[model samples]
Target: MAAYAGLAFLSFLWGSSFLLIKIASRAFDPFGFALARVGVAAAAMLMTSAVSGKVWPGSRPGLWVKLLALALIGQVIPFMLLAKAATLTTSAEMALMMGAQPIFVFVFGRFLGSSDRWTWLAALGLAIGFAGVGVAFWSPGAGGGAHAVLGRAFALAAGVFYGTGAIISGAATREIGAVRAVTASMTISTLVLGLIGLAFGRLPPPVTLLEIPLGPMLAMGALGVFNTALAYYVYFRLVHDEGPTFASLNNYIAPVIGVIAGAAALAEPVGPSAWVGLALVL
Candidate 1:
């Protein structure tokens, strides 16, 4: 029951994240935003592990390499893509688009030969979900323009990356323990995103940050502490306790919260198709 409660709370945190990301993107660009998120998250996780007497996984070059790959696929790439997409699309739309992640997870599970078995019901769910997504995006005029199209594409691609990351995380977590796995992965992601920021010249000069809005700055910090760090802690426990598919069930809960939160807080419009898509996703 405690585990279930934890997972539910984690879902709520993640559901609220789409709106936060959209808010934060106003101040930080893609690479910089991702870098800051993982950097602070890594710091928090490492501190928690240390305080809790969790031993670090050290001196394993192979494990580090695997962690690097997980960080890239799960954290860096998806985080950057989603952050970029948030700037272009409404939070409600992005949340529903993200709700399609489980379908892709099942598809990838087949290729990975994980325990996921697709039945007729699963196929029906997939079909319904895809149809719903189509309806949601099938709007008239500027709402379905090139930028929105591209943003939705990015969101979907992030979902694929997230699916692949889940598989990798499952294997790594089973071996190294969830806390250590997340700490290592976040550390690697911070480094990778930092380098990417430098390459893109998006790493802001320190003095320039004074001009950024306080609201967005606070949003970014909350994103790191609540969304990235604390959420990953709960998620890794879920993966370890319930398996990847079960942990991924947060995909179902979060988008609903996201839609409601976005509409309430941001006055974002939710069309009939969006409701259809959300229902199918649920």
Candidate 2:
């Protein structure tokens, strides 16, 4: 019962992230938005770890390197990609794209030494999933422009990265604890994103921070705290307690919540074909 409840809660956190990303994108560029999300999440996670008396991998440079790589693959790249995608696509479409993550997780797990057995049924599901993506991509009034198409592509790419990261993190969480692993990875992600922002001048200027609307600011706060930090803690716990394959099940629930939230909150239109595609993907 607790596991199921955790799954539902995690889905809500991640599902709502699309809407928050859409809101935050209005105030900051994609990279800047990504940086802020990670920065805030990292701070929160680190503080939690400290309060809980968790010890970090200070002596293990190799582990630090691994965490850094995980940060880039799982956090930084996907966050930026999804942020960019949010700029070009509806939050509903972006949420649907997340349905592809489990497919990638299944494929990547096979090659990455996961113990899960591959079956013909799983293979067929993968084929159907890709077909659903195609249906969504070519559906009428889907994106409405080439830029939106590109955004869909970016969203799909983010799913791939997320799958790869999940597989890696699953193994990492076994060595350390889930909270510890998440804390370390988020911290590394924050530093890497901050450096990238500095190098590329993507960070929002100090003065412009005051100019951001209250709605977007609140959205970012929710994103960083609930979506990134708290959601990830729950996710890693699922990965540790169940498995990555089981953890990816949240994708199914999250898209439904996201689509409904998008339509209700933002008045985003959801066409019949989009529903068909979402059903097929699920």
Candidate 3:
């Protein structure tokens, strides 16, 4: 029961992340937004590790290299992509697009020499998932336009990066504990994104920050602390207790919440096609 409860909470945190992204993006550009999300998460995770006396991979160059790759693929790239998508698409649509992640995970796992054998049902699911993506893209929802189509593409691509990162994470998590792995990777992501933000002049000036609305600032704080940091902790705990298969159930449940939250809270349109596509994707 506790495990199930944790799963439910985890699903809510992840599912509503798209809406938070939409709200937070109003203040920060893609690079700045991604940096803030990962930076806050990194700080939280680092503090947790420190309190627990958990040490990171201190001298292992190879593990550091792998963590760097995970930071870029898992944290940096997908984060920026999703933030960019938030500008062009509705939160609900972005959530639905993420349904493709598991499909990509399965496909990438096969090529990565996973022992899992292929089956007809898996193939059917893949077909259905891709078809659903096509349907969703066929008619962009509220504020539909060429830019929205491009946003959907970015969201889909983010899923691909996420899937690839999940496959790669197995190695890192094995070497270091899940919490430590997340901390190291997110720390690396924070540094990398910080440098990029500085290079591109994406980071807002201090006075400009004062002019930003309170709602968006609060949205960013909630997004980073709850949706990103705490969510990762809950998700890893669920994976440890219930296994990956059960933990992955969030992929199904969260999108429903995303759609509902978008429509109810943000008044984002959810046409018949969006429902049909979401059904097929699930």
- What TM-score do all the candidates reach, one by one? 0.92, 0.94, 0.91
* Candidate 1 TM-score versus the reference: 0.92
Q: What lDDT is obtained when candidate 1 is compared to the true structure?
A: 0.81
Question: Model 2: residues >4 Å from true position, as ranges?
Answer: none
Per residue, candidate 1 scores C-alpha lDDT tens digits across 252-282 of 7788998999999998887776787778777
Q: How would you encode candidate 2's per-residue C-alpha lDDT over 1-282 as one tens digit per residue?
A: 888899899999999899999899998887888888998898898899999999886657777776877899999999999999998889988888888888888889989977566689877877687677667766664557788788888988999999988888887788888888989999888888778778877777789889999999999998998899999999999888878877877887788888999999998998787798888877
Candidates by TM-score, descending order: 2, 1, 3
- Segments of candidate 3 deviating more than 4 angstroms: 1-7, 115-119, 236-249
Using TM-score as the measure, the top candidate is 2
Best by lDDT: 2
Q: Candidate 1: list runs displaced more than 4 Å.
A: 1-3, 116-123, 140-142
RMSD of 2: 1.6
How far does residue 100 in candidate 1 sit from its true spot (Å)?
A: 1.0
CA lDDT, every model vs. true structure = 0.81, 0.85, 0.81
Superposing all C-alpha atoms, what RMSD in Å does each candidate have to the true structure?
2.1, 1.6, 2.3
